[model samples]
Target: MAIASVATEYVFSDFLLKDAKEPKYKGVRLELALDKIVTILAVGLPLFLISLAFAQEVSVGTQITCFTPFNFSMKQAVYVDSFCWAAVQYQADNSPLWLHKFFPYILLLIAILMSVPAALWRFTGVPYLSSDLNFIMEELDRFYNHAIKLAKNLATLDDRDAEQDSQSALDLAEGCFKYPLVEQYLKTKGFSCGLVVKYMVCQCLTLLVLLLSCVYLCYYIFLASLVDEFPCDVRTGMLKNDSAIPAAVQCKMVAVGVFRLLSYINLGVYLLLTPLVVLAALGPARQSSSFLQAYEMLPGFGALSKFKPIYNDLSIYLLFLKENLSELKSFKCLQVLELLQQSAEEGFDTMCVLQTLSQVKTDVFDSQKMGSITNICEMDKPKN
Candidate 1:
């Protein structure tokens, strides 16, 4: 009985603690900090190493093999480098002078290759995250607005009409649920979500591309860093019978060290960039006001005009129409239309189109009228 009481107390305490824990509601501090730190190090160390390697490559050149004595042919010089390099085991013991000749440039190539992906990931990945952030922020604003609207309705309700008001509010809520504030916002914003979607897809593609690049770099780095100084057999093709040609040429490519550093840096940056991108994508998905923010640009277009997938289509069409009108002969009819239409469209800014239309001569109507219009404005086109 004593044990049971103690166990029950412990169970109750655990339940209470769990119930007390509030969900992180917004900007929710949801990232796994451990994974973040690990990613940082994993990404940073390689980049740091790559940078260091590059610095070394930049500071000290990679190739150092000397041409054999002047009397010897190019083949002989090749032979000298080949014979000496093939023997890194021998050079380690002997410390020959040729190894020092060609070291820097080889390392530079390595550095460049390694750093390429790292820089690319950053350049492409962060924009994706930013778009997602905007989406989240927009949704939050809309949610806040909806909440305000609900509170307002609740405050002004009449006791007798409570059921009716409740039903109306419920219907509005139901509609909003089917088509979120974020969705409405997206329409008002003019199909910008399409852009966001495109950006996401592009980011994913870039992620995979950068990852593949990193893998390729890793393979090359692994092999290159192993023994940068290697012997090349130049005995193929036409050089078979050449006694002057050494069996192998000692070519120490100095670029590998720099390349390795670049690769490490590249990997780290991409790893960081990619995850942030994923976060960005997910953030927009969960953002509270994403739909609302997109729509807020237009004040009251929701009831009659639906948001289209391509928001700017009408605007683009209007501009094109304006351009077409500008080429015409007169604007007598256009000025009147502009005077009438400008207040309504909040769009199809007819100023240029009207101005262009106005330039067209009304000479076809009457001589006296043409003369008056000519006085009001110059008609550069041929008057019919």
Candidate 2:
């Protein structure tokens, strides 16, 4: 067992050195799965639609087709298509028809705008939150390990040793298991409302952009549906006096059908994302109580409501933990510590507590092994 332990520690140290430049908390996600899903779909959908729209344009060969007199040659016909496309924007009567030419550009703009909120959060919020969360997780790891070891030590003590050293043992347990690092970190950060404000601003921006995109898509599809063919007056510039060039030629925009389809698809997705953004924005506020209640049973958990700033900060921390719950090992550590805290308070038998703590230690170790395996798999993934 000792040899195995040494080998395991050496391998872990080597892995750490190999990945020294990478983030220590690379497994931790900064955003919720919901946020990632919404951001990906919202931003990716437009880009995909733009590519499809452009592909349709390329496949069709030309965006505008104009009718010419029978006397006009093939070159003249090509000129008509080219001239109508160039002057598609200048035709005041068919202004909405111009959108068919620039539909892909519009989708590109929406994609860039949709991505802004995510970029804002990444730049403005991630650094502070990441450091704080990593620190809390590191401390939780230490605190839980200490608690489990203390439980095992207490379990092995004979009746005489336990009785004689009861005071010292209890003092050791209290010192080892007490909240210090995380609590102190939260206390120092309690007064800061910057993270909350930054988070809200990003969510609100996402909501606003989604709403606007839906509205614009609705308006665009309506206008596009009304006008696919428009009259193009090609008798301008040098051909002003040429009566043979026909006064007004009817031109059809070939790509309008594709644009309309893409618009409907984009609109449907944006509508779906709007509600999700609202839910994400309201999540921290609505769910803070239930999550924070778990920590209430632990020691040093003062009357949180009395200290509003501290409570808010703690809520923010729990919110991040909730976001990263699936990947975070610290959550299990916290659960074990909470159980230990309860056992100590209820005056449980040392042996019974030890049994419970052993199960917890087993679970924690199993989770850590799984996490290490997952990290290895992730590291082996080909870098983009």
Candidate 3:
């Protein structure tokens, strides 16, 4: 176990080295089961027990059911209870109390509060997991597409999984890449360095959240988890004037047992999530090394060699006239036009986007994305 933790840290530290280097091409992704049941179990059990403690308090109902002077009426009994209680200034033994009291509830409340950040993070943060997988999946699909396009001009498929799954998931994810904002988000400048960084950051956030939460829970747990046993000054307030009262009183909190149980559960979950938080920061590059490498190679190669960019600019100005020129389709024609236009004219400025577009290539169109893009593009189309 210790070795595994060390290994996890080692893997993360290794990432720091790569942060400064060019990313490699090894596209992997993380897929974990999302059973809200497990999440509920992790967070819910403690709260449920806290509730159960409340229920017990309701059923029993008194802090210390002392036999005050029988002469006292119910209200007077409460006062005597309150007075000595006030004098003792405490409760939690002899009978029941939490019926109206709020301390343990507050402690339980704290435990529940501690669970909130992690709970929200798990549910909200991880739902994105499926989407994230879709992201890599789309990226992989596009890589295949570009490979296929380039492959047509080149020889065999370089990547193993490419040629096969080509029609499989891509078929299902067809057009899934149309408006790949998430993928774009993954790659700031067509590089997913930000994705890894964001991932690491989010992990740190998770760790900090959990760590802070654990601190809260630990304190509450320490307070609540205590055997609920303590001593208090029995003769304070008015009782201070009374010599009959014991100088000091023994005080044992009633719900510590329940709070202890709650704390144990909270502590356990926090401990478990702590490492996952660490992994989140470290695992991105390893997970999507393939995609990163693909994205990284783009800027280096995405630029205009010379003529194409120049010709492309002239083509844009004579956009109407250029429509007839199918010559652009052949790379050889561009050189003949030899920088006829400025470098900006003939080049592929759209390469980065087109490339990223190519990376997320899908066989089919994302019905929804297709419609939206069509609607938007139709709106953006030049007025003829």
Candidate 4:
């Protein structure tokens, strides 16, 4: 009979283990979809437009036009235009006009600057944060399965005249349920704010770059409009004292109009993006404040309080029992005991657990209730 009973117990335990489903873990996305779309557009549009401008210049085969003297042949006129464009550094009084010559290169530089923050986050920040989140999620899954198995074992115990032995068994099982791994890991990571600080820095850098690029674009547009045409000094090097070559030639940059148009497009898009960058910068601060407020409201609970499982109010209830068991009357205690046993045997939904706690309050505690009890058991609903 003893051997038969032991074999039956093994079968029952195996059945319960097979019946408990392991929770599914979904990966957390480091960047929001909207933010990613905005980054690509804001950084990529100008680059694309600048490439188009360069293509236009190449197809036309002339970036500047300069008229030579009437006596010069077609080849000499071409030489004059080519020489002037190659050395097209125009100086009015003391101010320089080099920006007009290298407008496309400047736009390319701006595009590179705009993309730096996203690249930095992707390479340095995302990997570390992702690994940490995965570790935490896996640990939480293990803790949840452990709790369910303990509850099932407790429920399967004999509920006969061995009441004292059953209570002792419950204490022993609870003692074994302690998970020091998660707590120790958290303690080691408590002082590190590397990920949070990295996120904030990235946002701030993006915002600053956006503002500066807007200002630079506005300045370029204003200056380009005023000084697209300038007098070029062709009387240099070989033509320093030549009587045939003129000392100065009036020349006009052909790509200035296109550059101004590209600047306007870039400025319009960046102006629209300014508000998004501001909001992104503020997101972490708002979340941190809200999280701190919630944590402050819970007195005895520590950092891992945020990690309650979706279907396991009994785990938290057990913690409360450990603390307040002596204070509870026999009738209230019996109600809790019965609730735990039933939950372990048949399983319970969140609503049923809530109703049971409310009954315990109204029946034995004279309508006085612990507000934190409700807060603790309000686990996040699993996403479908």
Candidate 5:
């Protein structure tokens, strides 16, 4: 009774006492490095270009330059430049230079629109995926440790003590094998198409935004090619009756060259991102099954075989596992367990028992830490 009570207490205390060595939740990053890089380029490039455009505007000190009549004063030339820029859109005879005037603002809009997909993924998909990954990873860690300890105990139990109590061994095994928590947890996560839908939505949004921006840029470039200079009649509004002012002035947009260059750069980058987003969306579906099949030789990996259609939640989890495989200790642990299972054919039943027990023992108790049955029974002895 004392041994049983202490075991129960140990289990509960283990839950309350977190391991100092365990990583903090914030440290777990499931976002693909590819996604991060794409997002940075898509959203940052336009903003950077906008800054350049503004800097060019400041250096030149004006957006338009007009050829004023030699009879007019210096102030009249400045006025012509300002009036043509302000009234450029209102002139019916000339091609609208509104796009040229508002080029920096347009680039800012493109940057905001480009960030929409990344923002959607961050808010809608990231929280869900992060929480799921964290839970699955924690469970995997526990299972790995339990399996290692259980395997060691199984290996040395006979050699360590010849007359060890059979009843104590049975008690320990029964305690350990009582539940299969990971499988049960996984089974409950049925039809997690929500994650897939969210992921696809973000990718589709990115593609749509990229395509539209590229089209707009192509059109802008076409328009820019045809018109950089236009005739502007500045003798309107308050100055309509001024006979001294010329009927129209030849005005040129000073920043058209800079705007065109920025457009081409933006278009080129967005085109590159389009293919990357499409690849990211399709890559997982292509490799999910093939990757899992590689692990089918593992004894309990039959669970993975059921993921034939591969879009399910478990498959997604496995996809993430593949992404983070190098960082995961659990994969190495599972490989170790598989090797042990393959080597000990005669003790197959014992290994099966150990694996099953390891899963629950991870949650409920760890008898190996107690050292031996003699140590456990001694705790139950009555004190004088």
Candidate 6:
């Protein structure tokens, strides 16, 4: 039993190690770490402040305090406080002073406005970009695998047959090297500037909102400092003709100081974030070269070069299928046909095989079947 266990462990350990050594590629991140951090802070700070202001209001119990006449009864004084509190809005003569009443709500609005850009990116841009990147990465991976297989085949060729083998290998490499799927995809997508435009627009919008918010906060601070207290007219409704009740009462807004403090904090943070936002907006422009240029220039001839062997192998297989399509009638051939069908269904270019099949025009491969398959393949092709 111990010998069996040892044998099993020895056999499986290499497999586990090999799996562990395999390279894992995560597709590109659309937003940088700094940009994401800044976005969270910029949109989140205002909300936190708003919540703090609300909690303060709740704990303090009243936003307005009215000083009633000493001559009035307790109930009358209470009425005076309630009436003055309700009429506090009427006491403000200017629009700026009136804004103080809705300070928390305004802060909430600022938070929501600041978050719009991030929200838009998450909902609209991220999925589309992520999927596009994943598809490109998958194709690149397949190309890499094909290149590896071709290298192994070339390595095993006998020295005596070197001339013929080298020629065939060279031919295979030539076919594989032509019309790279990723390069073709990039070329087709190169004209579409929609994603770039969307990204830039989002950054600009965020910057604009930040600047406007800072201006509003500064303005709020200026106005809030001027008048936290206002005189309220209590003589209204039932108390309108009452001689005992004072005609006017002095009422002070309880949360104005707290609101002012929150505004200052919000303004300070936004000012810090302003440059970061600007940098994020201009990031794409800084990398003016084509998107894949950096990847192509990496050491060891980069990703595409490393996959050349597998590409050559794939080319050889394609050539074999093309030359002897009718001669190969085994289950493996049917499986290859099924794979071609699947690839056509998935919108891959299988036109080479289709063309070869057309030439043969065998009973097994009828014209109507070919036509329907061709139509399906064409229909499956992606629209730009």
Which prediction has the highest lDDT against the true structure?
A: 2
Which regions of candidate 4 are displaced past 4 Å?
A: 1-28, 32-35, 94-96, 151-190, 288-384
Model 2 alpha-carbon drift over 4 Å, by segment? 1-24, 175-179, 289-313, 326-330, 333-351, 355-384
Given candidate 5, what's the lDDT at residue 229? Answer: 88
For model 6 the TM-score comes to: 0.67
lDDT of each: 0.43, 0.68, 0.41, 0.58, 0.66, 0.60
Model 2 lDDT tens row, 1-384: 465345434433322212236556678888878889999999999999888887887898888888888999999899988988888788776467677777789889988998999999999889888888888766654544454455445445555676767667778767754655655666665566778788889899889889988988998888765688878787889999998888988889888877888899999988888889988887656644344444444344434334342324565676787676655453554555455545343333433432333233424445554344434334433468
Please, what are the lDDT tens digits per residue for candidate 3 over residues 1-384?
465335434432321112114332222222222222233444565577667767866766755444544454688556554554443323435332332245446545545654554455455544544344444444434443442343232222224664565455455344543444433443432322333343344445546656775785676555534444344444556667876544544444454455556567767876886665554344332232221222333222222112122112122112211222222211221221122122222232322222122222233434454344334334433367
lDDT of 4 by residue, 271-380 (tens): 99888888765544333112112222111214555533221222212222233323323223334434433433233333223223433432343313333333333432
lDDT of 4: 0.58
lDDT at 346, model 3? 29
Q: Which regions of candidate 1 fall more than 4 Å away from where they truly are?
A: 1-58, 64-193, 234-240, 290-384
TM-score of each: 0.35, 0.79, 0.40, 0.63, 0.75, 0.67
Each model's total of backbone clashes? 50, 0, 26, 0, 2, 6
RMSD of each: 24.0, 10.1, 21.4, 12.4, 9.1, 18.3
Selected candidate, larger lDDT, 4 vs 5: 5
Shift in Å, residue 157, candidate 6 = 2.3
Candidate 3, lDDT over the whole model: 0.41
Point to the candidate with the largest TM-score.
2
lDDT of 6: 0.60
> Once model 5 is optimally superposed onto the true structure by TM-score, how far is the C-alpha of residue 94 displaced, in angstroms?
7.2
Instruction: Rank candidates, TM-score, best first.
Output: 2, 5, 6, 4, 3, 1
